[model samples]
Target: MTLERITLAGGCFWCLEAVYEHVRGVHRVESGYSNGAHPSPNYEQVCSGTTGHAEVVRLDFDPAVVSLRELLEVFFTIHDPTTLNRQGADVGTQYRSAIYWHTEAQRALAAEVIREANEHHGGRVVTELQPETNYHPAEAYHQHYYARHPDQGYCAFVVASKVDKFLASFKRLVK
Candidate 1:
């Protein structure tokens, strides 16, 4: 069972984290900041968009159970790849859609996914595919936020919609 890791940012890490947690082969999802200037940036600093970082969820998964292509499909479905530097109400560089690929293979797969998505939607895919960079885990409170606070306003209104979409669209892929 070989495990691989990929870092992605589509909006608030909480939303992405919540969706991936239910993915069949996902081992773990850690909310973090990546491609930033700071060695170890705090959430506040990264939120300011000065760190050049995006709020990403570092996903550890089994390739046999869930291929990178499948993962990217879920990712593209849950987030708006056409939007630049924003996801819904969250607007900033930190919320930009991006894929921080860990290897050449992942890079190629990400590019293929983006190309396919763009072709399917008939619009430009704004999602950035870049090499993996330094990742700073967000504050402990931010981890599993939706699970721990499902009734919270943001989770209820925003994250829940994505979760529902994931569950509905990927019923066969769910564990």
Candidate 2:
């Protein structure tokens, strides 16, 4: 099976990681920092926003099982791409919406998805499209935060809704 990788940032990595972990085609979901100036940034550094890194999740998935277009659709459904540098109460450059594509085809598809999202949202989508760069796995504590701490206030209140949205909107893609 040929697997493809894509990295995405849309608000706190916990939210994205929580939802993608259950996606059918996804083999791995790693929370990380990417497309930043720092060579190796820790969670604190990334959260500070000075590192220019966005909190991202790198997903390894089988294209044959689930197409990238489906994944992008789930992404747009779970987060508000129209907002710049924030998702809900989270605010900062690190929380911005972005797609870090690993291949030319991925780039093209992401662009097309963003265009459709923009039109659907009245040309207000702010999701960034950039080549994958400088990805560093987040601290071990963050690896499966939602699964580990389902009752944690933030996870329960903020992250859970996104995961629910994904499950409700994309039942066919659920693992």
What RMSD does each model have against the real structure? 0.7, 0.5
Q: Model 2, range 1-175, lDDT digits (tens) per residue?
A: 9999999999999999999999999999999999999999998898888999999999999999999999999899999999999999899999999999999999999999999999999999999999999889999999999999999999999999999989888999999
Q: What are the clashing pairs of model 2?
A: none
Residue range with the least summed lDDT across 10 consecutive positions in model 2? 161-170
Write down the lDDT of every candidate, Cα atoms only: 0.95, 0.95
Q: Please give each candidate's TM-score.
A: 0.98, 0.99
lDDT of 1 by residue, 1-175 (tens): 7899999999999999999999999999999999989999999999888999999999999998999999999999999999999999999999999999999999999999999999987877899999979888999999999999999999999999999999999997787
Cα displacement (Å) at residue 136, model 2: 0.7
lDDT of 1: 0.95
Best by TM-score: 2
Candidate 2 local Cα displacement, residue 142, angstroms: 0.4
